[model samples]
Target chain A: MNTFMGYERPNGDIGIRNHLLIIPTVICSNQVCSRIMQLVPGTVAIPHQHGCSQIGADKERTFEVLAGTGKNPNVGGVIVISLGCEVVDPYALADDIRKTGKPVEVFDIQSVGGSVKAIKHGTELARRMLEELERQPKVPIPLSRLKVAVKCGGSDATSGLASNPALGAAADALIAAGGTVVIGETTEIIGAEHVLAQRCATPDTAERLYHIVGRFEREVERMGADMRGGNPSPGNIEGGLSTIEEKSLGCISKCGKAPIKGVIEYAERLPEGGLYFMDSPGNDIECVSGMAAGGVHIVCFTTGRGTPTGAAVVPVIKITGNKRMYDRMEDNMDVDVSAMLEGAMSLESAGERIWQEILEIADGKWTKSETLGHQEFSINRIGPSL
Target chain B: MKQQIADGVDALIMDNRDHVATVLREIMSGDTVRYRDDHGIREITAIDLIPFGHKIAIEVLDTGDDVCKYGEIIGRACFAILVGQHVHVHNIEGIRGRGDRAGKAGT
Candidate 1:
């Protein structure tokens, strides 16, 4: 099909799901916001251990993630819950989310009396907002309007051999159809940055690509720690990956052959209609969260060893190339391209399978991650907490 | 025309320029393994037992030589590597990602 049913946002973006999101501005407000989510069915809540005791960039990162999560097209309405004395400003946070033209309501525990009263007040607001969100109509939107993030984690040999390249083919197909695709994981791109740099659309983009990898390497040095200590984690080694270079060569294949449009900071908004790179950590949950905050509609996560991490505001479609892992983790995996390894299916055919899954997901089909309630969220931090 | 090798394909070569191919399954020493890529199918005898997913050198490499895979340099050979030998961290050092060796050759 040329189009899928989606909620058209007032900011001219298309969202596959219309969700009422309950956002807690700090760890102190998590219980109350989660209580509201439990009270109101169909409402989603992101409870993170940040927004308090965080200084400078760390504090700003928390605010950005909360605001970005609320501004995400998938969230039709938002409730910003604050502890009243946290570092994050609730009114400003609500106003930031309002830039998307979505309905945002802000409240605080101290101002609303106590936990019991706050929960009651938040529940009432959430119930009304959920009812309003449910009334939002799904209109037919062109598939090209979709923005997808490409990520791989728990990678093994099959990840590089089958799933990654297959996803790359799908990424290429989507880009060819005029859709936007994003690839991240700055740490994972170290050994293979040259290959990606050569594919950059401009000389400046190529230089920036190198700059980020160099910067990440220097940061790892500042800690007097070897990146190899953490990278190619024991799990990766057990799964047959020998070195970070081998793993990286495989990791970079998931973005397909599209020219790199530009490099963006973590959680930065993505440009429309091309392949872009977001500088993010290789940590699965944080990378996926960054993409969701950057306004991606979906994330196609490829794995061989397997993981069940999903995003709070975007659907994550898990694809694997190991038949055994797929069978072993059937509940977590969505598409199995292991047939390609056995020569039963060609790469193009395997990619077509993932592409079809993407279309189905875009048409409102729930991914295994979403159905299993995997709304894992984490913000990649660059600074220390106060 | 590119020839297609019969079954028993135990490894996969991603490109013609690759110095190594990935073992798809456990391969014992002396086993004549088959591999295929865009260029065509080829066979090589395993000199050492290679574990699944680990790479095996497809071509000989002298010390300090760059090991190419996926048609790009993934690492550098720290010592001589012969065809059919297991290619890994023991013999090849990563050219990137290590801060101490950022601009240095074969660690």
Candidate 2:
């Protein structure tokens, strides 16, 4: 129980998966990268629509997410494909990932002649990488090396009453074993930020938590709009969540009662143990993407209405507390704790169900989203694209 | 305690101080449901039709009073809430992050 199986990288990082990742440096090269992935069986490709006409932190984010994805321990090697005329430099991207000591190959469409030629060239490189990746062995890794991200979406009344608290218990269990846990969704924590601030491990950490919440609020106020309808989304109200405060009180319980060790910016790497809060949005795909880019190995997402999102790199384990949604969307759900509502299960046992599933996934169990090929990826944009 | 309900309890009063109990099943107006709080097992009558996962006021709440759940203030009552009345957005108004109430004190 103290160790889970993973592939150890040269940089001293452990990888639960050994994948050959194809990264497109710009939207123009996405097609070539997709073609390469189609031609190579065991490779994964991320075809995002950014990387051109970006400036400032906006441009930096795209590059950082790509580099971080490449550097991710889950990826054994990377093939950086560019259009040769984009703002992001393909060589620089490769160099950033090289710091992780993983094998990386870079090329641009202009230098390779065209999309057709680029796809052909990338396929050749990917085939070799896939062969090398297939040979990697998964060894037992200590639990202290594991980092998990706790997230929730499509929330309803049951989310607060059951799933979030259950996930919180499971998160506490992992932290007790010396693993790290991160909770995100800054927008969702609006009405309950003070409650979280009080649980921060230090005054500095508490200030950072308030600073992020205050900064986000100021931006909204400056725009002359309220976060009401958007945050409690129509779905949230229909599911019986009455107000932002009520929804938030329920939302904060998913991270358990662990003291907040630190507060990190969106896509910022997490520190070693306890619960760290990430200042990320409530959007499911964007939140999961930031956590993966921040180097989390897995995500435990709790929902009442059900969502079928999986990360391009890490496995997403979906948990639900609504019996109706679980039965209706059984294909998308990985764990169910609805028995709590029916008075058939205890809270500790509900959390234990999710805890056991996490250990199983760390040892290479494919989540429902992964089995369905739901490798959803997205990067949250902070500023307008130039 | 996450409010450990002994087996067979039909509803939950999450905290001893909460004025509302979330119904676990649909109940018609005037139906009685059993719930447990730190006060021990008790029964409350529904003054309005309540759906599963929706809260029922177990204590009378006057307008502008802080509505509590999980032992914390979730919002303020916008109207008088009678015991057993279904509590929801129609009755409670959140006091935080309101752009519409900007610059107003004690709204």
Predicted model with the maximum TM-score: 2
lDDT of 2 by residue, A225-285 (tens): 5566777887887787888788888999999988998998888877778899999988999
lDDT tens digits, residue span A1-386, model 1:
88999998888878999989999999999999889888988999999888888888788887888888888888899999999999999999999989889999999999999999999999999888888888888899998999999999999889988899899999998999899999999999988888999999999999999999989888876665456648888788777776677889899889999999999988888999999999999999998998899999999999998899888989999999999889899999999999888878788888999999999999999999999988999988877777
Pairs in steric clash, model 1: none
As a whole number from 0 to 100, the lDDT of residue B36 in candidate 1 is 77
Q: What's the lDDT for residue A20 in model 1?
A: 92
lDDT of 2 by residue, B22-97 (tens): 8878879978878986567898788788888888898999999999998888889999999889999899887766
The digit string of per-residue lDDT tens for model 1 on B33-106 reads: 78876756678899998888888888999999988877778778989999999988788877555666544554
State the weakest 10-residue window (summed lDDT) of model 2 chain B: B1-10
Candidate 1 residue-wise lDDT at B98: 66
DockQ of 1: 0.42
Inter-residue clash pairs, candidate 2: none
